[model samples]
Target: MREEDDKMNEHALNPSRMRGRRNVFCWFYSKCLDAAIEKKWKHWNCAKCEQRHNRQAEPEISLQVNHNIAYYEVSVKY
Candidate 1:
């Protein structure tokens, strides 16, 4: 039982959070937004990055949006 708890703890997180950041960062949120749309998911969350995105709340609002910012964010971050 303890081992199970430990495993869950390893991947657990608050309903909303940012992995290494105190706040939700833009790029990760944007990417997660894209993924949620692609997969037709209402929401998407990445435990590793601790980014949770809601497709409807993001700019993937059924319009052509520039991903340049997200790209730049990734390049600068990485």
Candidate 2:
């Protein structure tokens, strides 16, 4: 009985055991945003060096639309 209690305490104290759900949601959100960005722009160059040139200039509405599409795709898949 003591061993079982100790095991339960160890499991309860372990921080690594508590973060799986949050990590999965964060990963999905990142993937959805990345897909939206890729789909909206064509040049796909580094923003820091490229200075927004050679890219398909889109309005904010278009970006929001693409983001919604990508978010729904991710949500439906998983």
Candidate 3:
């Protein structure tokens, strides 16, 4: 029981070393507006999205790509 607890604690402390280390996924969201008319457009699954999907299954790993900026957001729900 103590060993199990220690393992769990280690995992919680070092998530990057946890089992099944996977690549991190990233996507970009952009907005464009028209000068003449007031309108907003949303583009889903852009090149970045597709690339992220093709990377890997694990989330702890990192991918190599050339891009301007990358951002990640977390979500939690009960």
| Alpha-carbon runs more than 4 Å astray in model 3 | 1-24, 27-39, 47-58, 61-78
lDDT of 1: 0.43
lDDT value, residue 59 of candidate 3: 59
Worst 10 residues of 1 by lDDT: 14-23
Better of 1 and 3 by TM-score: 1
Give per-residue CA lDDT, model 1, range 1-78, as digits (tens).
Answer: 465346335653333233232224433354445555676765444654433332223453456546655443334554
- Tens digits of per-residue lDDT for model 3 on 14-73? 212123322233211111012112322232222222232333234574556556666667
Candidate closer to the true structure by TM-score (higher is better), 2 or 3: 2
Model 2 score (lDDT): 0.32
Q: 17 in model 3: Cα distance from truth in Å?
A: 38
Task: State candidate 3's TM-score.
Answer: 0.16
Best by TM-score: 1
Candidate ranking under lDDT, highest first, comes to 1, 2, 3
The TM-score values for the models, in the order shown, are 0.28, 0.19, 0.16
The local lDDT score (0 to 100) that residue 55 gets in candidate 3 is: 31
Please list the C-alpha lDDT of all candidates, in the order they appear. 0.43, 0.32, 0.30
